[model samples]
Target: EKAEALGVPAGPERSRLVRGESVTLADGRIVHPDDVLGEPVPGAKLVYVGDASRVDDLVEEARGADVLVVEATYLEAEADLARKYGHLTAAQAATLAREAQVRQLYLTHISRRYSEREVLAEAEPIFPHTVVAKDFDRVRVVKQQ
Candidate 1:
């Protein structure tokens, strides 16, 4: 909007400005580049892990992720079963998301013994952004300016 408002032509000059390079406007006004982006738009980063039981270096791998999708096949009550089956519990997935500093967490591949609410209950306390993923559910993470 700033570019449009300032009459930055919708071509090469605009492209340069978008790349964080200074560009002189048609009216001879110069727009300085911003370290964080002159615009509010930001690229998203998504990380998805399936059927994870071992998370030793997962935190470092998923650092700064905008969205994380991991399987939580059991509640903490069945933590032993989760470990035996090589799957994560809801709490485990949430903890992974928190430690990784991800913006959003989606728990998937849950066992039929528990409802979505039950899975969310165990995860939300550890990470407020936790969600029980559904089939074909699309998540879009937009950062605040």
Candidate 2:
């Protein structure tokens, strides 16, 4: 669980460095901070939003993400219920994807009341890249050149 155990130097300033950027340590050792960061591949912004009822608050964080994984726990017909339970509807999830301009969107945490088809139907029209996530489904988000 230590960053150094994973070959990444642990420190407060590590996150602020970008790819190919380097910093010199007090002990005279040089470190390329980005080399130890997550997402070894370049040109992709990956985001995951869970248990979020409101997407409006996440607009800035989700902007221009290559892939966004979010929750759609209710159908549009159950908007009131979704709000009460602090969960997003399929439509709302799609709206968030559209607003964020994410290249791909995967919807998860669906309520048992709706089928996978129903969730996809509600989201696809709003955001063409939307998909319903099933158990153990693996999705790859490749950055477009």
Candidate 3:
């Protein structure tokens, strides 16, 4: 009801669309998919990616999104674990963001075992503008400059 009041569709149009997922990294850090996406809040539309296999669903739903919040939970060395846990690494998330043509990409749901510097280092090579989310940080997404 609140989401509707703020113009977010009460439900996704596609039944196959994902709302979120959970996973454990090779380093033993646990992450829930929604944790990466911040909160649903009142205004934003959400299309969760429950697992990596659902990349197609993510791509389709993310089309034209002004802001795309994704996860880079692996370091490629742990890609096997990434697949096992259903999360994407920095490269994968950036690829999806590019393919979907989203205006901005915010990477989230990181393994807490890593420092903020490490996370940024892992994500920057792929997504130039990627920002690792910090608690209480505010990101304003307006349509245009």
Candidate 4:
């Protein structure tokens, strides 16, 4: 029953991802990702992180996500520096969020050089739903209809 509550199938192989199969929770919620098995719980709050850089690969995985928390390690003016360190700039992170169609984007792991205002200014135009995460910031993720 514990497995069932978490939406994992019962038996030795408690959980496995099979294409086209969705795990149904006890409360009738369904969990499924666009690709791959063992992805985060669906129909619940989902947070996808691009880590330092190379967020390009996360586009598909992040589609329809509630919140995409990616690194915005530098301002757009320092794009070259960001690339050299394998990190993303504010604008790049915003663009990724737009392409993925995520509901909201929270930019984190920022470099010390940039102020929160600078980061927000760079990202807001490209993706209006973007926000720069600060210490102890509380954000609520709501599921879209």
Q: Identify the candidate with maximal lDDT.
A: 1
For all predicted structures, in order, the TM-scores are: 0.68, 0.71, 0.58, 0.68
**Per-model tally of clashing residue pairs:** 0, 0, 0, 0
What would the per-residue lDDT of candidate 4 be over residues 14-86, giving only the tens digit for each residue?
Answer: 4443445556555686655333345555573465565455676778888878888888998988888888888
What does candidate 2's lDDT look like per residue over 26-144, in tens digits? Answer: 56766665445566556778899988878888988999999999999999898898899898999998999999898999999999888888888899999999888889998777886
Candidate 3's C-alpha runs over 4 A off are 1-54
Question: Which 10-residue window in model 4 sums to the lowest lDDT?
Answer: 11-20
Lowest summed lDDT across 10 adjacent residues in model 3 is found at: 9-18
Ranking by lDDT: 1, 2, 4, 3
Error of 4 at 17 (Å): 15
Clashes counted in candidate 2 amount to 0
RMSD of 4: 8.8
Q: Which regions of candidate 2 fall more than 4 Å away from where they truly are?
A: 1-42
In angstroms, the error of model 1 at 133 is 0.8
Over the stretch 7-60, how does candidate 1's per-residue lDDT look in tens digits?
777788878876778987667878765622454645787889998886767999
